[model samples]
Target chain A: MPADVTALELAGLRKSYGGQAAVREVDLRLPRGALLTLLGPSGCGKSTLLRMIAGFVEPSGGDIRINGRSVLALRPERRPTAMVFQSYALFPHMTVFDNVAFGLRLRATPRVEIADKVRRALALVRMDAFEARFPSELSGGQQQRVALARCLVVEPEILLLDEPFGALDRHLREEMQVEMRKLQRQLGVTMVVVTHDQEEALVLSDYIAVMRAGAIEQFAEPIELFDRPTNRFVASFMGVSNLVDGIVERDGEVSFRFPGGARLPVVSDLPAGPATLALRPEAVRLCAPDDAACRLTGTVAFTSLVGSRMSCEIKVGETVVTALVPRHGSGPAIGERVGMALAAEQLQLFAR
Target chain B: MRGGAMPLLMLPMAVLMALFFGAFAVFGFVSFLQPASGMPGYQGPLGLSNYLRFLTDPAALAILGETIVFAIVVTLASILLGYPLAYIMARSPYRVVRSLLLGALVLTFLSGSINRAYGWLILLGRRGVVNDALLALGLVDRPVALVYNWTGVFIALLHFTLPYFALTVFGSIRSVPVQVEEAARDLGAGPLSTFFRITVPITVPAIISGAALVFSLAISAFAFPLLLGGGRVRLISNYIYDQLFVAFNLPFAAASSTIFLVVAIATLCAFFWLEGAVTRRRAAKRGAA
Candidate 1:
């Protein structure tokens, strides 16, 4: 319970099925009252890692410590952790009130205290009015709220959620993501969420661990992970559409040499060698062909409207670059020559 | 084409049902006639004398009451013995364990009923393996009366009905999502608590349905009691068989068959009603909460 001690820690945690490893040597230290998201694609071992922390799935190696004490030997029911499953596994035979009070009843809490705590937990999720309803009677979002209340009522030391909004529609999923973040801040409870959605992680997490295969690819804050991804995989996963393979040349000044003898000024600390430049579509501005700020010249091959932005695919010496510009006028026509001005600060360079 | 072909496809089943019900109707009509000492063994002048005789005969009424009580006991015993087996078969993590249990149950189902009855008699006879083991172990001073009475008949009947009960409940238990039980454990309930509170309650309807099936199967039992009862454990089916074959009184047999049919139908109706109430009360209990 000390402030300096981490709320949850995993040291060299691993899981393997037969010869194939599902999670390999994961180490994390989450401070108290902070939310961390394990973001990854399907089958990336995020769910398995979360299950290890919840004491549902036994780790193949290493230890999981909660409150600076090892909980590896404890059973799931004995551990001080609760999880909200993706399917919202609520007891169909029990009312919402009883579902929330189940853990308290197991602990032999007083009847009056159980009722009081269940009521407050339901209120926390804005589901106090549905105490008398069964889980089958509620909508998906409402059942999700009850599922959250059922876990929160137990006052676990660490809360875990496994793709909690995977069943909801888009608009509702976004709303619950924001609401979950707000509730976590208000309660100041340490939490871990597993999700395959990058946007959901960005909206809900204090720190995001983008995972690939069975390891953490990059772990950082939202802005840092999006703007300064450490590798090509992280860059692509963060929606960087343009990855131009080039070489860094330090002749006179730092410059990136493209494959077809085109050079563009860049700022990097890497020595002159092979590298890849990660450019976001929205970071490129379409301008007049003779503009002084133009960094590349190409002919537009295709144009399409994306909401309020126009996406243009420009062919630059056998390499196609996509630029997203505001849809004010008719935008660029196909086969029209144009200049692309890349934002210098937003450009990311990665060693190949 | 979809709707038109359905009825034509059902025509054979309709004819089969008509023949079955037609035979039952003839038997029911015979219950109202008077028995005569001749071929066909029936006369005109319809009356309820056969029914009145059965309603008044204390010995016959006693047999009916005893049969009902025995059926109830066997049904309750099957539930107790079969539920755990069904649970293991449905939820055991090991495929070998589940397959072994299911294979044994299915093997019992596939075997001939008379063959199984004779097998039980050989195993449970006075000088049979079970009694010999008990005597050799010095657990009993004498061989227990396991056959030729109520005990032998009860054991055989339970064995016969267990597969019906267990298989009926197995599919239901499998349908209860594994995550529901895990959610209970994640919420601080132990394994046993999760089973009783979450898994069992959710499968109540199936349990009742299985119990109903076993009850009806046990109540109308004719072969086990005939083979193992040693003329002592005569159930309703045995009584009807005696009246028809031994006594050659077709009208009386028809009357008793009608009564048995009515009782069986009533019991099945009650079970169905209880199943509905269990499901409805789950949703209705919300108001009280």
Candidate 2:
């Protein structure tokens, strides 16, 4: 209950559907006013976790504490939380004002107070002008904003959104993501968002909980997750990354030896054995061949022009290593031999 | 899309009006004819004697009152039983249960209403299964009079009306997005309050349409009411029948049928208009609120 404590905490949170676990040992401590993104692919238990927090899905085992108090026994409405559903869930019969005022009305708030709160919440989401319009009349972005207003009007301790902007177009999605992030900061309300888009997660969340196979793979700041992913799944799942199979040789110098005999010296305490060495596309520097601790010479097999970067796939013996270089820079053409330098700091060693 | 076909489309409309409503139009015209009492057809020098007799006859008036009361009560009773059953069928979590309920409904529908009414007659008759069970259970000392009265007719009619009520209510409730109701609960509405605030308000159109259907069917019901009501309970349709075949007065029967048709049409129109107006008013109120 302390002011510095987390707004929400899950201790050994688990959910099973007929003996198969949907969420496994989900332990999280979401700080007050912090926006945490439950980042994962579909069926990775992010939505299930969010629903458990919302009390829509009861945990098979564990404690869900909101504001440092256990709320597993409370119904969704009794909990100090509100959710912005993936479908927006706006009542078809109600106007924008009524939809936004839905939560307040349930609380038996006075007419004048409800009106004021609804207006303020709508204005917070920049949807004040659309009060008289029905949800069917609004665009996707407008409806999402109204959904947010509906949650905000309730003044819940935390706000949960499941793929909050999944229904919007690419342009509108990006715009709403930024706008919602700003609103979260402005309101200083704790939020837990579920999304599979890593870039959106990075841009919107203060911390990202990368989930896979019904368990949290890593829960850390977005920058840390991008740079120092705890496992190969996180490293490869985040974006384009080269996971070359190799064995660590820790004699005299720690170096990775691929099955094809290509060597890249790595710094790791992992015992000498087979491993998957992770290197980001951005971290693989293209350089002239020379005697270096972490360098490999390979021929570029393909080059894909992606935004302002040319992502080239290089073949080093039987392994294809992907690397990103700026588009404007001089780089190896397809079938050209090139020397690739791997940064040791960026090398993620995952033991088999 | 085909602006030029507007007049051509009226061809079907004209044909339908001529084939169907044309009979009623003829009846309306005949209702104004003066006829000798108890005559099979009018010996006319056009007058309003038939219509006036229909309006002033005591037996006809009683039958009219009986028909209206029967229809209203049947509509309400059907709704009370139907809404909950429909709600269950619509929201049943198990697909098997939903399918079974729907299958039973369709099977019942495939069987003619008259056959079903007769089935109900067998079940509710004094010497039938229901009364026998009641007697065996010591719930009744002797067989009670269920048939040959309004109660028998009502029960028989309800058996047919329930299916309409269920199907319409089920469709209307099913059309409401499940997420909307979940959203209501998430917003702190209890189950009952959520039903009143979200489910019921949204399904009003279906309720009104279903009620109108049941009401119209009940009022014009002929065979079931005649079979069950026997000689005690006479409805407008029975009276119309008596005037036609029993008394052999075609002009008076035609006049009475015309009045019944007009009233049924008027009731349907008023209900629909009321539904539309209420929807608009709700929209306006919510917008202003």
Candidate 3:
């Protein structure tokens, strides 16, 4: 695949609205054929950053490169990129055929070619039979499919989506997520999807860029991001994380000491100093008193019988921590004394 | 839903309609009675001679032609001029400015025709400010004749009808959400392409309605045409006026008035038919989709 050369590069992108910085000095790169997601909360700069790349928004300062060529000054159409809007801005007046063929028609492509390409794009999105339907006549998921078809038919070097499935119901959203990942992989198109949903990011991205207040906090593969988030922000934003205040002792081991005189030994190369220890809720286990590890003794604050798992909230001092246990297992009852132990390798220690 | 209100609401309006209809029926019957040549009152047998004369009159034919042509021209002019303005109004960034523009449009139509034409007369007449400016700028050697002609009539008609077209078009354009435009552009379309292919097509209903409104307004206009067209241009209304006032032929004039009324009513029916066609086509397209 020639290692799929860097398809897009953003160097210090910046944007502000009404003196409020929406995005600031953000930099990232996407490899060819890679599906990268900008994941963060609502107020985060994920969508703004995506807009800058899509040319709907101009960066206050920075350069955008595609295929090692500068494209910062290019208009949206001039640049070889297409965007799927969160609202699925399909042309309500146009038939599905025309909407999908819009870009080719703009380029003055031949009629027969446009028809062929539109059909192919529609097939890719599994909407081949809906070519004559207007956007308003379609369901939400169908509109989203047509939107995808429209962008795909353009055959752009990079495809961008801004929370494209945010309007879909949960089941449709999950289905579209799977459909999108499959289509992107099948076409080997370099794609960027902006989403606030962490699970959507996890499921759809090969690489996830966790954004925070106008900046890229961490960029890595999904597993890399989940396993080793460089900062507390990425770790906490990505999933349910239990953060413990701790101090690094000698060697590679660390100990988290709470106000209640409970000490937990953890694994980290972080130098001897005050730190915050983060571990995924799934990484901690409910253990018997004889089981040895970094244990925290607390009363079960709450318990929820989720479909496949029993989620128990354990209280350590005044801080409430959650642990997910297998559904059939015997778990601690609410208000019962319990001891939770963190696996050594699962603990993430960040220098405070 | 209110107490003792249903009958009260219907009674006053029903009485008024009955009175109005009764007067129309009486006058219309009187118009049909033949007049005696030597007598001071109607004495001849009831006949259709007056109606026959009205239908065959050359002057009536000319007035009808003038009315139709005037209506078509003004409607076309309004549509051509109002569309861009409406588009701009719809897309205006400032709500205050948009509201002010709409308010100005309302102001144009609120005043009587006599007032509006008088204002135009001062601006468009020879030796008026516009002509003075043109003369001073050396654009013309003499003051151009602008008032009391077809050109002046057209100007007044356009001014009256333009605001109507603008408001209707504005409503249509504003109803089309911006996301549709953004979607088109995001699909790799340039701004111009997005507008013509998407935004313009979506607002076709507005354009149709605006044209219809301007046409209806232009056809019935009496005050402006009478004031600005002078005697040289005799529309149906002016012809009817001349028959009743100058000719003093009440039967002939009433017959002519009835003919004109029928024609106006017919034209309005045709306009509605055309709207029906457009709406039906739109509905069919939506159903097909």
Candidate 4:
């Protein structure tokens, strides 16, 4: 394969069941040795798209090319892609070694070479010592590791996983997410992971494709997606809690006019009338009501502890904007009047 | 609720067990006695003469051997035909197909054995529907004898046993997750390979159980042999019936029944043992690999 050829390319990929679309016009191109994540909520078609790539699902209209060659006509057994199911569908009768060796045995690899490859694969997942145990005897996380080894041992052109850590507890899920990222980098295998957890996607993916309603909402790096989401849905999905609907009037200098007669200067090329401003919770700061830089004034309506920070919901007229501030000495009391400061560069404006 | 009521709850089961075993015990005791001449019951003198006659008589031993061999063949044939029926019943995507297969099996099960045997007679007789078709098609110059022989008995016994085997394995096949089989395919195993290596091995316990049930049913059959055998395909059950009714030899019949019971129990035990060994060997095979 040429160096310029992409590892996986999907163009206009779509699937519909009974005339109802499950996946619609999906297009993506992933270079070799990169990890991409399809991040979305349940029923958002992320898993459906991954299954299409692995040849388990047939596309109603689209092209799926592995290494720049169309693989639409191949069967699942003939495809070069492997999938780790959400349920970690390991054969319960087979031991870990045999489970990982299943693909090699099917390919008619020599006995000695199969043993070597299986051992190496097990060692990669840190499960070499438990190779002789059945899947029923292993814990959830251990079975997940074995599932990964089973896919990796075959050296698939692209590895796909559907909600791989959905079964693990919170603590173990985080640990495995980081470990999976490390292993992916170590092997430098092109991989696509589907997850509903944004944090897991951020921790593992080199590029994230945020999806909603069977369409890609945004595709960018984690920092880029978090810092600058293009739409309100993407903003909300990326954990931006404060969205203020207002009007923009460009009188010599552009400024956003709030509902309660509050005005704040903003930088935007959008010739706007009605618009929405997405502000990160951490970007809003609380200060004395009479502070010189105070752009919006409100009374503290609610306060709650969030780890090392205090989250306050400030009521400005009928709209409530949340601000996350460092917890210092119980923070601001409820009913206290406060002024909210907004960061200029952090403001993302979207035409409503 | 406590220990006080436990024995009372068990009293009905105890009574049932006593009645069942009490009859067998009486038969066993009678097997050791002497048959009274010109009577229907046994006499007082105790001896092993009945067992010795059954063990040493070549003609009687041949019937026993033939019955055992026939049962084994019927059981194997049932599994070969029934597993595919079960797989289709559990896995067909069409609701109408699954329902039709289940309905057919249940209908076969609900019908009386003698009814099914007579139905087979009408289908497989010399001038029956099958032979008529063959003659009309010019495949056979004359009507072929398909009844009143071993073939008739075999066909009737298979019809009687197929439902038991298929229904027994149907639930087990359904319980094997579809994703597990898909995983095998995703790992490069073709559909047939996946079925044989994954689906079949996973359902081995159910297959063994189904085979055991039909094996017992086939070995102890009486009605089909009597109705279809026409006195030529006499099995052990018919032979024992003749010994008791025709010859009025109660002691010898009791002895034969005792021997049959022991053999059937041993065969079932061996089937269960094979199932256990298969599962255990699967686990132990990991070390060697």
1 against 3, candidate with superior DockQ:
1
Question: Which regions of candidate 2 are displaced past 4 Å?
Answer: A1-3, A291-294, A327-330, B1-17, B36-39
Computed on C-alpha atoms, the DockQ of candidate 2 is: 0.63
Global lDDT scores for all candidate models: 0.92, 0.88, 0.82, 0.92
lDDT of candidate 2 over A76-161, digit per residue (tens): 77889889999998988889999988888888899999999999988888899999998899998999999999998898899999
**What are the per-residue Cα lDDT tens digits for candidate 3 across B1-289?**
5677898899999999999988767657756876555443454577888888877877678778888888998998998888877877888888987788778889997977899899889998897889999999999999887888888889988988988999888888888778678767766677887778877788777777788788778877788878887766667878777766676666666777777778878877787787777657766765674
**Candidate 1 CAPRI category:** medium
Proportion of native contacts found in each model? Answer: 0.88, 0.60, 0.60, 0.65
Indicate the worst ten consecutive residues by lDDT in candidate 3 chain B: B35-44
lDDT of 3 by residue, A1-352 (tens): 3446899998988999878999988888888999999999998988878888877788888888999998888887788888888888887767788788888888889999998899999988889998878778899999999988888888889999989899999999999899888888888999999999999999999899888898889999999988888888888897846876756666545566654566676666777878777878877688765666537778888999887888888888757778887765566767888778776767788888
Order of candidates by TM-score, top first?
Answer: 4, 2, 1, 3
Q: Which candidate ranks first by TM-score, i.e. highest? A: 4
Q: Which candidate gets the maximum DockQ versus the true structure?
A: 1
- If chain B of candidate 4 is superposed on the true chain B, what is its TM-score? 0.97
Per-candidate TM-scores read 0.93, 0.94, 0.91, 0.96
lDDT tens digits by residue: candidate 2, B1-289: 4789888989999999898988877877877875567567776788777888878988787788778888989999989998888888998989999999888877876789778778877988989999999999999999988988988988888888888888989999999888788888888998888888999888988999999888988888888878888788888998989988988887888889988888888888988998898788877786576
Alpha carbon deviation, residue B121, candidate 3 (Å)? 1.4
Note the residue pairs that clash in candidate 1: none
Model 4 stretches astray by more than 4 angstroms: A1-5, B1-3, B287-289
- Compared with the true structure, what per-residue lDDT tens digits does model 4 show for residues B141-224? 999989999999999899889999999999999998888888899999999999998999889999999999999999999999
